[model samples]
Target: MAGGAAPPSTARGGYRLSALNDDLLQEIITCLPVKEAARTVVLAKRWRYLWPSAPLFLNDADLPQPARDVVVPRVLAEHRGRFRSINLAYFRLASLDRELPGWPRLLADKRTQRLQLTNRNYLPPNQIGTLPHIPADILRCGSLQNLVLGFLKFPVDLSHGVEIFLPNLRELTLAMVIISGEDLEHLITACTALKTLKLTSLTPKRVHLRSRSLRCALVGLSRVEDFAVVDAPLLERLVLYLPGTGARVKIGYAANLLVLGHLDTRVHQLQIRDMVIKSGLKPNTMASTSTLIPSVKILAVTVNFGVLSELNTLASFLRCFPNIVTLHIESVLHDPSVSASAIEPSGEHHAKFWQEVGPVECLRSHVLEKMAIHEFRGDQDEFEFLKFVAMNAQGLQSLHVVLQEGDTSSSDDKKVNEAREKLQDLRFQTGISGVLLVLPKEGILSTLQKATDLTYNDPFRF
Candidate 1:
């Protein structure tokens, strides 16, 4: 009776329900609601024990008043074979705690791959009690791949002598929960196989990211002042947004890094924008061309600047990327009162012009060919920035200015045309036939969004 459900009914041309085999029929029961699966008992003797014994998904929060306390453990005691994930609300924890080493112990069993124990009984993301300490048994799970815990005062507080190890966790997401920095560090180091780790909306005392194989790491809106990427040799993509002011991040090493944004860079395809790390005080000139990424072929930056003094930072930034062939700058005007001025190849901080004879190898390199300016406002400062890029690239192929939606009024159109005339006029004399494009935002974003693989033709999308 325990091993087999009643045999499958043979096909009756009159009744189609009789056609499914015992195994197929049992699978259908697993997808049904508990009441519907239980009702299958009345349909035929074959389903008598099937409903209660089917792989269960029980949420103590779903059962009404009195049943919440008693029903889960009663059914789980009788449940045999495999189980799909479990959820327990905060209110039921007190009753369930009495049965702890009995019911909570099931969560540690090898078959449960995903486990979440939180307070859906309280409120949206947090509630009115001490956050639960993760069971020591659940922490030692060798087969658990994804674990999520919510609204705990602290995520985990391992008992003094307990040995907690999660050898196979791949994706771990913790929200609105506090954990001591040392304990959190131990939890991450123990996972060994973690690929994606996201820590959101919690202020830990210290954060030391020392992972060798992490691929995608996102630390959002962190306030931690002492943060360091001690070592992450295999880390490829990272987004670190420390929205809190006065936080300085130090990147020790990410040698194989690619596609880093906002968090700061390690190499090749680098983007620096308004989103890039800010020094809180005025930004000093970007570090030297040698200390910065020497292998970078494309450099993108977002700066909030307005005056001639600020425009100088653009040249200083460009000087650091000698191997750059593609450059992207998004104008973010931080001060409206400040004005603009003409660019000088001989300015104090400006590097040698692309055409100037200089000791530096980049001038002769001819590697800079493409430049894209996004959110072009046609302001005096923005115009001067675009004009400077076109004038400096001796081997320039195309310079694109994608205008913001408001930058296209009738008067704005004339200014845009005036800028275009400068490029065309210079092209005849210089003989560097780089195409100058002033595009509307929608056309380009739509093209890139529609294609994921670099199948689209937009140079910026590359």
Candidate 2:
């Protein structure tokens, strides 16, 4: 061996990754799961000390159940760097009370940024009210940006004059959390910089929101009987993804609202400004602007066009958003098991209902640029609505018809071809040259990640 030659590298066959510099190695370790990241220490002598130098990311849900209790505390105590994110979603509230009294302090000390501390224990609807309250200290993380708390109770008492604030927090998600209206208001008002808020499966009877900085809000799978945007000047997107039936949703004073949708025509009672929308309500006349909401540029509605009353409800619903640039229609299939007397008989007059429903200002005024129909079963009623849009939406540049999955009668390709042909025929008659796209339903499900993303223009598109 020459005197100046470098010492034989430990880089062995198939272990070429070790040849990379320490910074790259640390980054690779940070991206791995906590378990796999920890195991990297045993890979080589050099790798043994690299884990603690990188930022920590711990998710208890990814660890084995038996090892979680031991591993979480041990890693939290041993880690010597800041925490990138922590998700303790697999632990019960009772376990946290007994085993981790200093957990919140540990997080703050480590400069933790994103935390998801969830109680995974199942609670029935009646028991939810009695669930354990969130630890006050957990809300004190000043460096926190994104927080997700689940299956806990929010403290209702603000009597002590103690304030709760997260100055840098941006995104917050409360999933299956029990919260009184007063505390809910306080919590939201405290996060002054907050941008995105999601309320999922909450039992709160009423949710009245008021935020100046909030942009995207989603209320889904909740039993909230009344939900309203009380005063949000900068709010843009209000999504009701799968709200329970009989919910009344009202939009008030949100002048910048750009995207809204999935308003179930059969179940939701919609009110904009001063007007309470109903099935029989007609489009705005030349003299009245009270019922119109012109700030909304994107609108989504769920309807069973098979039902005559719901079709009319949809017509009334669209009349409110007179300046909608994009329209998303979720076609709900009607049940055939109902008595024949309940079903509207299909006829020439029924097909002409869209034409007779007067004028939808958004379509007739050429503000609607893009239109998409989801869960399209190729039913006649669905085509009627598309035809109406095609003929009236003079500025519509793109039309997408997404077919429902599991249609056994024909292949997906065949369904797409048939839909394209029908759309072509409609275009031929209307002299519309807009691009038409027909897509299968596979891999197009909307995800929570997309729902919370403020940058994603249309969260409900997929």
Candidate 3:
């Protein structure tokens, strides 16, 4: 009797169909609004008991203090034993100046599979210790699969080494919580089945993590993925950010596992910084030259020119990612001539010394398919640099050059016309297609019109 509906009519009389199966009923319940799902009991005589089977979705924003008090008791009275998930967000209980006593008991229910509690507002002093009450109960629920707890001011203590005993837990997210290093280590060791773990605003400054089943980890700390702290065996995707000046951080991959197998299988995506590659190295000595992450097909690198003295180091590091088809550089200066004036003059021949360092050579035989230079400024050195690139980059299909306007001299205008003439000639010589020169927003039209006229050859053609 699926959906409590009657069977197809026979010629003789109406026949009652069997009740709906669990899977079909669950699907229908999921489609219904929380209020509608709860009210479905009044739809028909047979549906009176079916509303309890509907999955629970509690939005704290919609629940006023009176509404919560009214709904919580009614829900517990009707479907207390049937709830599978409870999502609580920004729930502030005003009725009870003290913590709600029944909240922990409800989470302890064996049927509860997922629990999410997030309080973004500042809590009163008395409510600071209320977080542990929920975790204390949830640890007993063997069916718990996902747990997320975020606190604004409540600091957590993991010094005693709290272990989530739920063996089926797969996802865990903790924010603004404090955990001791030893307790953090113990937690990772205990949660062998966890697949995703995210930690933010953690205390004690650092935590050591070693897990066999962890697949994804997002850490926001001053130092994350320190080789001495993390030793995850099956971790495939990691997003880490380190904040704070003058603090050194280092991360290492196992020598035997240079190519990340999980990434190759489409199960992992790695985001690593260029600074991480240069950390923990002597001035001239190179870091480990090889990585085991062969499965990585996409890489986004942010090269800090301030840290890298030579541009060749950036190129050499890119070469390591062999499978990289698309490379995105956040802020890269292809033409080194832009920073010429920034160098301080030292002696009588300082100008000559600076001139020699101006455009070394253009990227000739690079593996990239496209290159985008943001804030591009063109001069004689930059134009010559473009010509050098035109000679190389055989696979190059697209080129984007963005220029910033500042002070322009008459000599600069003459050099630009000459460069445009050379580019127009090269465009005809080489079959290379799709060349776009983007100028500054202020004087773009005039610049393009002038460049086009100088390079125009239609009038000379018969």
* Model 1 regions more than 4 Å off: 1-78, 87-95, 98-102, 118-129, 155-162, 263-290, 293-302, 307-384, 388-462
lDDT scores for all predictions? 0.55, 0.78, 0.47
What digit string (tens of lDDT, one per residue) describes model 3 on residues 1-462?
Answer: 778665566323532222556556656765565566777667666666666766665554555655765665456445733556666665553422234555555656636778777655535646654443334555556677887877732224543634467678888777765455666667666776887777765654555667778765655554333322256666654444333221223334322221121111001112232334433122234323343234433344433333223222343344345443343333334235436654322334322322333221112334445544334444333343345446555555565544434434465776445544555655411346434344444453342233223243111110
- For every model in order, what is the number of clashing pairs? 7, 0, 11
Question: Please, what are the lDDT tens digits per residue for candidate 1 over residues 1-462?
Answer: 457654435223324464667777778887765446657878877667666656666555556767766776665666674566565654456567675445656755526666676655544543434555555676776667777765664534543455766777887776656676777677776778888776765557477777766765666545565555567777654555434533445555666544333422211112231123323213334444334545445455655435333344444445545666666666655433434443122243222222231222332356766766666654554544444455545556666666665667776777767766655654421355434455556673353233222232222342
Which regions of candidate 3 fall more than 4 Å away from where they truly are? 1-26, 73-78, 93-102, 123-134, 152-161, 222-229, 241-249, 253-296, 304-325, 332-462
Residue 218 in candidate 1, Cα distance off native in Å: 1.1
10 residues in a row with least lDDT, candidate 1: 265-274
All models, RMSD in angstroms: 9.1, 3.9, 12.7
Ranking the candidates on TM-score from highest down gives: 2, 1, 3
Candidate 2 — number of clashing residue pairs?
Answer: 0
Better of 1 and 3 by TM-score: 1
lDDT of 2 at 145: 95
- Cα displacement (angstroms), candidate 3, residue 380, comes to 11
Candidate 3 vs. true structure, TM-score: 0.59
